[model samples]
Target chain A: MYLFSAHNITKNYAAHTALKNVSIDVSAQTIFGLLGPNGAGKTSLIRIINQITAPDEGELYFNGEKLKPHHISLIGYLPEERGLYKKMKVGEQALYLAQLKGVPKAEALKKLKYWFEKFEILDWWNKKVEELSKGMQQKIQFIVTILHEPKLLIFDEPFSGFDPINVNLLKEEILNLRNNGATIIFSTHNMESVEELCDNIALINKAEKILDGKVHEIKNTYKANIFEIGYNKQEINFNEIVPQSYEILSDIHQNGISKIQIKIPADEMPNQLIKYLIPHMEMHSFNEILPSMNDIFIQKVNEQKQKSF
Target chain B: MIFLFKKLTNRSKNPFKSITMKKIRLIIQREYLSRVKKRSFIIMTILGPVLMASIWIVPFFLATMSDEKKVVSVVDETGVFVDKFESTAKILFVYETDLEKSRADLTKEKYSAVLYICKPTNSIPDHAMLYYSDKSPGIITQSYISNAMQTILKNNLLINAHNISKEDFDLINRTNIKLNTEDIRTGKKSYTEIKTALGIFSGILIYFFIFMYGAQVMRGVIEEKTSRIVEVIISSVKPFQLMMGKIVGIALVGLTQFALWILLTFFIITSLQIAKPDVFKSPKTEQAFDAGQKIPSADQIQLQKLQNQEIKEMLTGIFEIDYGLMILQFLFYFLAGYLLYASLFASIGAAVDSEADTQQFMLPITIPLLFAIIMSNFVINNPDGPVAFWLSIIPLTSPIIMMVRIPFGVPVEQVYLSMGLLILGFIATTWVAGRIYRTGILMYGKKVSYRELWKWLRY
Candidate 1:
């Protein structure tokens, strides 16, 4: 059973619809990527799930029960925008915010200390929030959000400012959270990270989910019979061995090597081409290219635009 | 299940209400500890009372210590009014010296002034030439020379004209007036007017703090909002709790400062007395003087007499104030008033998203605080009047206005009525403020105005 399900969610910002009949059931202990470009309704749906807002038309279910304010305690939300009290000290402020999230003082402090020390920010406990660098402040915020060990963790562009090393660090922690039986929702425009982290993907374009499925399945579903052929022989005549079922999209030849993109009908798949071409040509490499998440996003968004007009 | 529900539906209980006592404690602690801890606060608080004490004690100190006298070389060519100067204090008469030396001595400030006596002829010059560069001498010194001249003239008149006996003529001129009276009514119990003044003063102090500290709360809210920190806090805590926490925290700070200031004042006055015992000495012959020299002309004299009578009435009225009642009412009104308006200030802080948005709402909140000030003065004049009753019963004005009227002898019924209404107003205002706070803290990027606030209140 899904731990949380947002069924047919619809939200509007005045006259503009931000979410249109969007439904996604996030199962327990899995990382769900709510992937979208800027201005997509990913944030709107997340806000609906968090109950920071109410959907104009939808139902929210938590473990097969209706969601209420109490459900907030079950979710940990790290918003994209950074917010911290400038005059408040880091440790004291973190503890206070954590308590408000329902952890008692001693327990909150215990958890906060562990996170602070783990992040090597124990000395920052006494310093005012303004004294810390942006990354340090974000660490404090992250600790406060996760101190309760919430069941559902929603990260909205969590690693935007992080350098490569810290990015890997945060990525490891995110996976650790999922491993610890916490269902996660990762929202970002960074498709490479999504590919690395996301188990399932929901692509929102123009306030609509144009595509949603397992990451591998979605990549496979959007695939066309496209292959890249690289060869040392530059003067190959594609008309000799290539079937009429295939079309050459791009060709490049330089430095005694040739590279070409061939789109073939699924009936004449890559295996059929290989069968016909091995004797006719000496091939350095022949590979059917799987569509990447970036390519899928671009293709889906363009398809959505064309459909809307 | 019950525990889970308690965690969830604690909604019925005010989200802000849990932090009530602690927030107030923290706020007051912050205000008090921070302010009183500063060296400047300690110095100023201590200095103010010391200055006040010296104001009361310094004159006597001056009169006692002032033994040095001004020596005037009177070149009285005319023998008139030489003896008139005898009544003046702090002046000495010196024998005539060379004109060049006296003029030179005046430059050195050897004498306070040099008096040049001119003979009065049918053509008397409008002014007598004083060798000293100073425009005027002390009245006491001037009177001394005048008295000396008068005595010499009197002696001359008696010697030249009537050849009257000097002793007999002096006997005829002396006279004194005496009076005795009984009050028409006796046993009238009057409150010490100073005590009443103290109450009104405390009331005004409370009034000013409510405005000043209330704005501090507003500014605090604005700071958090401008820095964008409020958004993070709002997500975790209800806006009402946040506002109350801040208000209560700052109020604690204010109370702490007040207590520290009182202690410092006591210290300052004590040190002052110990350091300078002469300040407590009684004056032998010090007198209040007119704004100008001597006296004004006849018409001016009549106007001055009327003004003096008015002043005497005011002094007497102050003397009639009831100290015990005034103090009690002052405490009640101060707390009630501060609590009442502070909520408004807190609400104002919450409504406007940023500091820049505060000015538009500042006038509305500030005007009532000012009205309390104006009404405080008014009710001081007419304590039992209908206007006083009306204003005091209204919780907003009651704190300040009732405090002023208490010394003037407000009835027990009115005090109770005012207190009751003030508490009720607080309950209502807090409710309204909590609503506005919850709404406004979440709202950003919108210009909230009075009309809009009204809409929010309705919502």
Candidate 2:
């Protein structure tokens, strides 16, 4: 079942359109990556989902119900440029934000204590936000964003300011939240993290959703019929052994092994390439090559750019 | 379950109504607490009463504190003004026969100035000259000497040329006329002076409160924007709610400070009065105390009794004003005026990325307030005139101009109309400001212009 979805979303500012007929459906308890380049309407769409700004034309549903103001209480949003009140005490600000989301003060305090202890920032609770380091402040912001235990959390570039270790910790916590039935909408240009964590993704470019599906399915759909072969070099000549109909992208001879990348014909199966290659040489390895999300992101955006021109 | 049922019903009726009040309350609570807990707010709260009390007490102390006495040597060539000069606490007069000797003594710093009265070429002396080395005589001293000479010469002329006796002259000069004004409708003594003072005091107080608290609202908005917390905040609450919550919260802060100041000032003044009853005595009584060595004659005692009666009448005049109505109107105008301007300030703060960029937007907002203040004197002088009537009716200037006219017995209908118009104006400005603020807070790194703001309004 879909946890949240935006249908035919359209938004415009005075000078230009921010979004155009975009649609997205995020399934329950899945990490949905919203990928886009700078100024690509990802923020606009996220804001629409958060109800920070209403879409000029669209309908949004949460848990199969039309989105309303009350839905805000169930959703936590960490904007790209998120911040806390600088002069406010860390714990006080956290509790205030939680209360703003409709969490009672006692419950908020209880949750804050748990999170603060888990994040090892309990000592900094009484310190003003300005006195904390940037990473520490970001941690506090992260904690405040999720303190209400929202069902749907939207984080825009959540790992931008964090050190690698903290990023991993945040990643683990995000996964843990998902494991506890919380759905996450992650927006970022960090394709590696998308590859590592996202179950599904929608690629938006120039205010249009050009691609979206399960991450593995997208990688599979974008993958060319290409395979890499690693075999003993002294035993065979790669050019002579491979069929002339096949396209050899690159062939390299290093040490005692020869590795070559070749594209199979549409009629052939992956096993066919392995079967054809195994007869000629003692193969060490044979594998089909799948595209990375980064490669597909670049290729799709570039293709869209060319099509527009 | 009841919460869920209510939420469902509210959603069906109006989708945006759910949780708004709670969120706004949270925002207000945070805003109020953060400010009230600040060191500066505490300092100002304590300092405000002291400053106000000092404004009343400092002048009295300064009046009683004696200054260095200035001595003037009189060299009357006419010999007709001897023994006529009177000495006050600050100035003393002494007669000298030799003009050259007086001049020499002045240069030697024996006297502050040497006043040389020329012999009369006609009925009155044509001119008089004053000489000193470094320090010049004050205007008060110069006028006092000239007045003394003029009075003595006039009496001499009356006695010699007109053949009038001193008794007849004294009796004719003592024909002092005093006019007591009464309101014809109420048949009560009218206190125009006290009413004018009250009007000006309240008007100026409201004007100051609006600016001081309005700027605070703007700064608070700017702080939220600069810190980049506005996005997170608006995600939870509507921008309008956030803006209003801040405005209302800061207004409460202003009211609290004002209430504390009034109470503290009253307490301090009363305590001081009780601790040293003599310090709180009337200035006339204080003067009598200053001249402790002199025993008051029968006439002096009668004059003091008359002064005491006048003081009592003044106190009755102060109590005669409808303080309840005046205070109610003051609060109404204070909140109305502050809300009107604070919304504009919030929008300006949202439109700019920094405080430095607010100057351009601040001009238009400040102009009406300044114009109202500038026209207040005219309004006070001619409360029933056309200029005052129109200014009091216009919402932008009414908060101050109407206040200046209120104490002078403004018609109830006109006050009602002015108040209704002010509320409408506040609503209109808040609508425009909320529109601008919603768009402006999300926009960054762009230098917003008037055109951009216009576009934001449309958006």
Candidate 3:
């Protein structure tokens, strides 16, 4: 079941329309990546789901019920431009945010203490936010976001300020949150992370959802008929053996092995390419190439821009 | 990981709601406590009372302390004013025969200044040259010599030429006119001068507190916005709630400071009175009458009795002021005024991204306050006039103009009308400010114009 969804959501700010008929479904226990370049209405849709803003014209649902003001406590949002009170102590601020999400003080304290200890930040609980480094502050904010165990979590550019090690740690926590049955909406420009973590994804550009589907299915749909083969028989030239229907994109000889990348014509299939390659050379490896999300994202946005112009 | 799963599976029921009273309370608590614990808040709280007390105490010290006495040598070539310039606490006179010798002495710094009395062109000379080394004598010393010469010339001419009695001349010189007023409605009489003073003092105090604390609220809002913590807090609570939480929290801070100032000032005044009874005691003006000469026993007794009567009237004038009602009205006006202006300040804080952008919006909010202060001077003189009535009834200026009128005992219905309008005004501005604050807080990196603010109001 879809844990949360914003259908036909439209939002405008004065003369500018921030989101127009943007819709997306976030299924339970899955990571939904909201992909877009800057100023593409991604933040607008995320804000609508979080109920930070109401859509100009559409509806939002949480757990199949019409979203209401009271449903905000069930939603946790870490905005792109997020911060803690610079002068506030970390533990105190964390507990305050937890209680603000409807957890009682005693429960919030217990949960915060556990998380702080787990993160190995118990020693810095009394430190003011301004005294911590930016990455450390991001960690504290991350803890605050998940401490309440919100049913729906939305993170906008969550990995921006994090170092590589901490970024990996956060990616682990996000996956962990999804495994625990919390539906997550992750919005970022980091396509690699999206490929690794997101089960379903949507791409928004110019205040419209341009593409969306299960990650693997969308990648397959955008794939070009291409195959990469590596063979130890370095004496054969790829151009002589390949058929006219296939084209060799590149060939490189290294370590007594010849590797060539070939793209077959649209009518060909991956198995035909593989069968043809195996007969011509002692194939150690043969694999068809599927488009990466980054390539598909750039192509789709560019396509939309061209269509509009 | 198991703990996360167990809680998730067990959480079939929803416990969270949007913008709950509980959440607002938490927001308020956070805003209040965080600021109250700040070093700046603590420092200002302690410093507020000291600054207020010094405003009153510093002038008192300066008034009571005497200046060093300066000697002025007089060369009366006219012989018309010899031995006339007597000594006072701040100035002494030394009569000399040779003008050149006095000039030489003045140059040598023996005398602070030399009064070169030219030969009298007429019965009363118009101008006199004062010679000194480099700098002129203080105004007080020069005024003393000028006044003594004027009096000697006028009295001598009146006695010799007009054959006027000395008693009549003295009586004429001492004549002073005072206006007596009685409130027809209350049937209470008072000296107008004292009532005017009470009115001005209370009006200035209200104006001062409102301007001070209202700006504090604005600065607090700017701090939250610039630090970018407002959005995180706003996601949980409505922007209206956040703005209110800040407004009310700072109101409490203002009240705390005001209460401390009142209590501390009272304590300081009381302790000063007890420790040194004469420190604030009003000095007798009889010393001025006794200076330069002596009077007959009969006249002296009569003068003393008259001075005693004047002091009594002054006391009665102060006692006749309705202090109980004035203080109550002061508190009411102060609070209403603060709420009315503070909401506007909060909205301005939200509209701008930083302190630099506040200038455009600040002028409109402050113009009424500035006009109110300037009009209060007029209001004090004509408390019952139409200008005072209108200014006091209008909510924008009422807080100050009304307080000025209250000490002079305004009509009861006018007071009710002003207060009713003030409350209605506060509610209206708060609603308006809440709207602006809601949209403005979420709007980041946008240079807001007046037109944009109006659009936000509609939103």
Which candidate comes out best when scored by DockQ?
A: 2
C-alpha RMSD (angstroms) for model 1: 7.2
lDDT of 2 at B372: 89
Where is model 1 more than 4 Å wrong at Cα?
A7-23, A35-59, A70-73, A203-211, A253-258, A266-268, A284-309, B1-101, B115-196, B271-277, B282-328, B351-354, B443-459
The CAPRI category of model 1 is: acceptable
Candidate with more favorable, higher TM-score: 1 or 3: 3
Count of backbone clashes, every candidate in sequence: 26, 0, 1
For B71-156, candidate 2 gives per-residue lDDT tens digits of: 88888888777766656666677899899989888889999998898887886675788897886777877787778777777888
> Which residue pairs show collisions in model 3?
A70-B18
Per-model TM-score on C-alpha atoms: 0.77, 0.91, 0.91
Candidate 2 lDDT for residue A141: 89
- State the interface C-alpha RMSD of candidate 2: 2.6
- In Å, residue B436's CA in model 3 sits off its true spot by 2.0
Q: Model 1 scores what on Cα lDDT? A: 0.72
lDDT by residue for model 3 over A88-161, one digit each (tens)?
89889899988887778999999988998888999899998999998999888898888888888999999999
lDDT by residue (tens digit), candidate 3, B1-459: 446533543352354333377787786677678777889877877777678777766666665567766888888887768886656656778899898988888888888888887877776677789888887777766776788888888877888779999889878766766566676866788677887787888788888888787887788788778777776777777788778877777777767777777898778777877887765654444345545454435555666677788889889889877778888898899999999999999999989998899999999888998899899888877888999999999999999999888877787999999999999999999999989987887778989999998998898
Prediction 2: B-chain TM-score: 0.87
What is the TM-score of candidate 3? 0.91
